[model samples]
Target chain A: MSGDTRHGVGVSPGTAVGPVVQVAPPVRPPDDEPAPADAEAATAQIQAALATVAGDLDAQAAANAHAAPILKATAMIARDKGLAKAAAKHVGAGLGPAHAIEAAVAEYAAQFEALGGYFAERVTDLKDVGDRAIAEVLGVPAPGVPSLSGPSVVVAHDLAPAQTAALDRAHVVAIVTEAGGRTSHTAILAAQMGIPAVVQLHGATSLEPGTTVAVDGEAGEVTLDPDMALLEAQRERRERRAAALAGVSGPGATRDGHAVALLANIGGVDDAVAAGAQDVEGVGLFRTEFLYLSATALPSVEEQADVYRKVLEPFGSRRVVVRTLDAGADKPLAFANLGEEENPALGRRGLRLCQAKPELIDSQLAALALAARDTGADVRVMAPMVATAEEAAWFASRVAAAGLPKSGVMIEVPAAALRSRHVLAEVDFGSLGTNDLAQYTMAADRMEGELSDLLDPWQPAVLDVVAAACAGGSETGRPVGVCGESAGDPFLALVLAGLGVSSLSMAPKKVAAVRFALSLHSLEECRALADTARAARSAADAREAVRAAASPELTAVL
Target chain B: MPQRTVTIASSVGLHARPAALFVEAAQGTGLDVEIGRAGEEAVDATSILGVMALGAKHGEEVILTADGDGADAALESLVALLSRDLDAEEG
Candidate 1:
């Protein structure tokens, strides 16, 4: 073998070759740390260490406006008088300074965990603060992403939001994490920043810090000590991919002139503004959860409308398909949480939560209607996690009552996809949320990194589901589109188009490649590729079969 | 001492931004303020850790007491802050 190769989930598309730089995990107090001979001096040291951490975080906050609130809050935690007193109490009880800090942090962490929900989530922020203080007390280097000296592939167990936010983007060429699913913070941030990233790589942090490695983010492969020939090939492919992407622009179309609306999937106003400046037609997925996730109370309709307006104003008359709040399970809103469940994925979430609390959906629909009227944008509202025709009808009636033009439902539940003909009859259109669809179809939890194989969008079963949903859409004369991670994959985009998906929505940066991929194939050729993939025995085989069937020019760049 | 009883209006209760804002406001006041559930042990209102550890939730009742200069004015202002949904306001 030219070099040892490791596999992971390719979250962000691209390639990079650079030396590895491992991010150090949070520091722990030494088990055998001895008690200080002078308790007063120990207490003083503990206080000073916390203050230093607070000061450092404050400085960092001052420099990064995007991360300022988070950093400032962490700094505030460091300077808490209650925390200081707790540590001092531990010091008086004969624990070393570092040990005292750990005990104090654990005390508060236990309280936060006991509180549960949003309070429990704060425990991570608390622990980060504690780790920083402990590092200072022990006179060790701070834990988390270190300052990069040059372009490097950074490896870590899992990157926290704070760590990812603080990364030296200019010098960090690629990211490999031992843990994190496709929807994890690291994966989302990497995709948004357009950096090459591979997640769920086992033993990723074990690579020698200075060892040269080649990261093929598209292939989810990391090769140690890559040979000169492999590196040269990667460099040439990078150039060729760029040139190919540059050559193709404007609205997406097949070689035969079959139209495929390429669009962006955005979460909020900032994402909308950025995506609007790109070459895509308009937003295909507008996730509205960001407004409610952070709020302790539901935002007023006016407040919601203002945010929606900002998101819609960018697209003008272009279509912006908005998905109503998708919460519960992985992302729980404290205000709207439906309590704990053994199986949150299958529990009351998305439209189910909306059904139980009609007021929530009512307010959201009202806001979307208001924003649509004000901005004059072609706004279409969709409900997530709809499992039945009745659910779709119920949502459609509400959408009409709110005066919104078009109503749609996300065909994520297999039941909905199976009966989509009936479901689509009740709505204006449909969109496939392939991520959750695959998760539910394969009986795999999307959050379980170990089950990534089952969650792969290339699985023949998932393709069948997509084809079934498309058949339903065609039967009802309703357009169906894909607004999921799979839509961003160039090869998969063609497959979706072949399955009769009228639109493909992905990250703004990924739109170009998918658009270019479509430009190389005719509708007939895409259908042939789709048929070949669906006939395969396994996900890997399906992918290989499609790759083998695709035009060589198209596959070369990918 | 001036005391006021107010129900937490924030949908998330007295936590996160509300807790931080409440603590900052309490600290800005030159009075010694304490907050707690009725008939429970009170914590320093100016301490963010203590306030967050209180584990207060939306629609829960809290008792605020302050002593020293401008105690009445401080308690009144604090009560006003707690009456609104602080989390709903834009940053």
Candidate 2:
């Protein structure tokens, strides 16, 4: 075996070892490639290419009505006069139509990419035009995932969202890319699909196709033609970890028997059902954003209640902590949009947005109450972005008035964390949304990949804030759960338990690892670990300190 | 020159389906049309990127201008288009 190794940032957990098959980037037209000399013929050539691409897209739009808006929009781009005129100008200048088309599209692509956000998303649509047009002119099959014959690790420079969507999960065991970060589409998709992926690998694309490769998503290691001993070691380690997790289930607790409930953080019915199938104790945080985000209409109490019932039906008697409609400027409800806001993060969002439209808040509360009654699930209601004791009291009253079993408030805003004891006095429980809490406390937008350092959950400041919220839970004798994206990490779950978090709620797939991690450490050990973490000066250092002091077996699995 | 000043009525205002549909309608007019936010430089209406780049929000005023034989007709058509909630219309 040709033993070789490389490292990159691993965005998803687990390990994968298979033959490497590189997914080639879309073919680019040569920059200096000359166009046809005859201006009239070149014009017709460009016109024909555009027409074919537009027709193909139109057909695609028809075939995929759900995607018609985006596909048809791209088709319109193919027919836009600006592109045709730009191509014609180049043809007139003695450049071939291909060169002209490339240049023309580049201009629009550059503009769209620069606009960022919404316009930036449209860059893919524009570039889709270029790729299809270029493919038509070149007579090459449209660049996309090539049919694979067997399980293989697909390596690439970068996979466009379309290409990623087209990827055959049956054939690709893992994705290795040269240019992507944790926040990139590839990483996000990989996480969603529960695939092990290593991104930003420097020479990922250069790996020869069909070479046996092994990827450790946790370690972010890529090994080419690995020796059998190394492969066996990875297999045995994985088996050991799986076996340990398999030995334990039910509510999470430590070796010394201090109770820690391992719960699921669900978004909608699908998540609830999937998590219900796992060994989780109950739903700790049920995000109600999907109810509002899914459609244009402000759902009626009956419609909302019906969906909540479906989600709660899966859990039966298990507790489902349902968060009220959390529509914000970022995730705007078509019917309840407050128009454009310059600072959406700081502006009307979550509880504030719902407050702006009391009907939205009222109907959602009524739905949760009715759904809880219909499904007979142990339901607890919560409000997101509650920054003050008054807001908490208001949310609790609404939940109580609706006949909900209990009430809670999310600790996302820094203000909520600082005065959490007072806020907790008003609600039945408090859950730390570490993702948003990290963002607000660190003064960094979690969406911005460049600011990931400050948004790291392990950051001492973020942990300190979480500890403060948990302290509130103690003062009020209400359970505090970690329901952010961070709770999924086994190490972070341990740290959360150490900080007095009563429940660990995360994606269901992560429950096993966290459950096993909890069994390896006692509550006292967790507190000591948290103390070591809080004393650390940096996120990386805190993680290392915790890992250094953690049980040897636990650290190995982590 | 024939022109019209109209407020954007689409809920999302000149973006996504609304923006693309707006551009397609403008292209159908044949007569060259330019659109811009009030007091801002107008750009070619036929270009979706250019139109969306205007970032015209709901209830915000935008200026649409066109020239030639059907210039007034073009402006009228565009004004009518912007005055409706294009997003609610069936695709």
Candidate 3:
């Protein structure tokens, strides 16, 4: 602690000490640029700059398969003949090369924004291309994450999805952002990649590059210029944590043998393969949105089944809980978009979106059914954003019609959690998506990093909601599970289990720590800890109380 | 000169991946090709930005015209590409 400490929200767990690498914000064209001496030379420079940006993006696309299509499309925009002509016209009118490029991008951006929906989202991509070309023309470093030379901490105002996708996983040890909530793309990507990450860290981008900083992801603290002793202590704790995690394996349970199924929350085939190879029980949340997110049209049933089969085949005879397409205004599909909405979070999303386009859900269910027939894995289907028994029943009926074995609903809405018994009766099981549950419970936007205090999972109101949902599951004799970022928190896992959640699903990297926590407490101890947390007045108090009540061994490494 | 009129089949219309693919194919043809809605001004089909600016929605009819060598064959190929859902294919 012999250094200045800055606090933020910890979205991923780990510890690292590395030199800071500040991500430069998008560059803007200087307003006072003199007209080029020769218009012909200026136009040539603009074309050359755009071509260089396109060439760089083409190389990036060739290197990363996951971001290939996006990068390639962006490259196409960079090499666009129309855009070049527009810039040339501007340069002919005596505008500088950089200014000309900016004007040209702005024109297209305005058109795209006017179109709205999927087109509006592309404006970011278009503007990103503009920034790169401008930087090239002005002879400055490009915006976004630069190539890492060693293990370093990446500090940024916020990372765009394309920037996060292009991260060098091997060299980047930690991620710190000045803005983002727990469910933001940066948080989710860092957690998925098992990198130490902290978000909402004030003045994070102001940290000098090459200055050493020690980041404690669990504590959400960054210590600038830490002493040797503190660094040594962090290294020891990391090693001890790894050793302890390696000591535990197999199914998750309490010391007294109260069985709690530990599972993985996976998005695609790659995650499935990686998590399946880990020592977890099975997949608790198989998010099906990835299959549709990148596509311009709904995938054919066979195409979806092929992907589903590949995901399922890794876990033989193990349960794979598949959540159907959860797209809405917030994460709109290109083809299934229900137009624009003023409030996407509260609008037609999840079950509501499915209801609007029955064909979308039907095809997904049909594909899951077909894939289940092909694989040995036990697959169950669920719908997200379900708020009532009627919605649950409607989804269950659709699942049955599709010939799926079991059906379930995500208990995210506070209304659904409060009346879980009735909802559970209509479905086989339920999983609490605590992230969305917290958002809806607090009536706070999950994307707003400044309001993260209200969205904390440890909040008494959110816990009470989870308890209500779990109570419904118990009353109906159906198992309820938690499959959210909260589930990955080792301490919070104890509180959830105490609330009678039968299962916990999280990033596979987090399973060992949670399993270790569960092993340190009996069912009674966990229940008592839950009671203590519920009795606390605030989220911070509840967290502190639970930490104080937990086993010393669990608290030591944490 | 040769031309054909066809409806866009990609559910998301002529934007994103479909627009990129169409533009790439049009450029590959090395013919002067143009696309637009009936009774509307046409744009260079080889320009990705121009094709996207058309804002063609799914199932909307768009006329395609091509001139020079192998114009008919290129128009026929372009029409066939537009008839099927190009977005549905695996990238």
Candidate 4:
């Protein structure tokens, strides 16, 4: 049993070997507790507990700058004078510190819960403070993730988003959860943070808190008390991967010199700055919705331009494709909240929402134009979810009228892909949003996990729609690109290039891998792979066919 | 005691980051600061819960009252803070 290995789904790609540290679940106060003989002393004791909890939270917030806002907010709940006064009064009435704190928090929690919306979420914060105070008073280890002093593998029954957010990421070498899947918050965040993660490892939390565990995220294997040789081998493999990726850089091209402009997908000014530093060709998908999504009012053209300038300024002369504010029923922009809808997925969204509020679209266009001119960057604005040629033309003219350099339409809808020539004629470029194209083609909700199978980008139908969109671009001599999750997948990136996509944009972290994938084979080989994938009967079959035909090196990394 | 009235400039009103910042600033002053909606009962400006419970929205006028030697200075600072878009700076 020296080589005992437990298998699970590797949600993130990497390997880590460290001691396990189980995050203790929130402790509950005993329902019944005898009152202290001295009422004043009991009240003082609870007050000290509250202060200690508050101090701990304040220290934690100070330690991690990113968690300061949330942690400081929770610390306020703990140090709340009103909460303390009520709890002390309860203690004066002969209730125990734990019970008093719980009751006091509950009183505030009810008020917050009644307020609804964003306020309603604060009840959890209040409860967390209550839990900490209760744990401190009872002399128990604090609930939630315990602070780590060394590199560790965090073992949890299931990480709540709050706990996941609060974890001291520097100390966490790997994350193992007994529950959650690839799409779980833990997995998604782990991937984004570049952490090695394994999910659904049934008994991960049962491991002794300080025992060593070797986690292989790529292989989805957890080895308990792994030997030195195994750890060294894993380290060597990681180094090799790093070396391979380091070998490929600059503008992406195949061995046969078929140039594919590999660009980064950026969400905000921060993302734009970070991605701009990476080895990508340029910014292919500068998502502008994030700026609008976080605002309560429609930002003025100047305010919007300031944000756009922040994003475009970093890229300089590099091409930056910005998607205009694309919010609607589901996303619900605060300035233009359309309210509850029967079918938000099929309802007014993206460009459709822009039509309902031309002022919003016009303001955004003016801002983009101003930002483009200010930075001297090549900015091509795009419209999302454009279904018809008229909508595409409407968006292109608006973009031109605002003095933006170029216009493009996201080919996300099936209608746009099928009648691509008409849509392509109205726009300067076509960017296939494969994720949504798959969702629309299969009539699957992009968000609903149950419909995830139908939304798989590897499905032949999805590829066919993408091919149609690409063909439209080729016919019109307009450049076509992919700015979807599919573009990030290196093997799929090849298929896209084969289908005539001139560029690919994805999360900045994925650039190195996709670049490496492109460097392996010629454009003709990519076309053959795409042909093989399209001829498959199913998504699984398509993936397998591509894998079978792919170079061994591609299969190894993918 | 000194008091100043100011309109909330934060688009999200006097809650979230704005409320937190206001409470933090009030606590920093070490003076008894009370804030209330026009003609309403004042709550402790240092208490996040009390401040949040006010449910003040954007463009709503609120009165700030402070006691102690620096009371006038504190009220003026708070009023100035409330007049500007505090949330906008954070974003």
Interface RMSD after interface superposition, each candidate? 1.8, 3.5, 2.3, 1.7
What's the true lDDT of residue A146 in model 3? Answer: 75
What is the CA-based DockQ of model 1?
Answer: 0.55
Under CAPRI classification, how is model 4 graded? medium
TM-score of each: 0.89, 0.76, 0.89, 0.84
Which candidate achieves the best TM-score against the true structure?
A: 3
TM-score head-to-head 1 vs 3, winner: 3
Model 3 is docked with a DockQ of 0.53
Number of clashing pairs per prediction, in order? 2, 2, 0, 0
Residue-level lDDT tens digits of model 2 in A388-430: 9999998888788888878999999989988988999998888
Arranged by TM-score with the best first, the candidates are 3, 1, 4, 2
* Chain A TM-score, prediction 1: 0.91
Q: Write the per-residue lDDT of candidate 3 for residues A279-364, one digit (tens) a residue.
A: 88899999999889866679899999999999999988899999999999888887888988999999999999999999999999
* Reproduced native contacts, each prediction: 0.70, 0.37, 0.73, 0.53
Candidate 1: the clashing residue pairs are: A296-B11, A296-B12
Chain B TM-score of every predicted model: 0.98, 0.95, 0.97, 0.95
- The residue-by-residue lDDT of candidate 4 on A349-391, one tens digit each, is 9999998889999999999889888889999999999999999
The alpha-carbon lDDT assigned to residue A69 of candidate 1 equals 80
lDDT of 4 at A377: 93
C-alpha DockQ of every model: 0.55, 0.23, 0.53, 0.58
Q: Which of the numbered candidates is closest to the native, going by highest DockQ?
A: 4
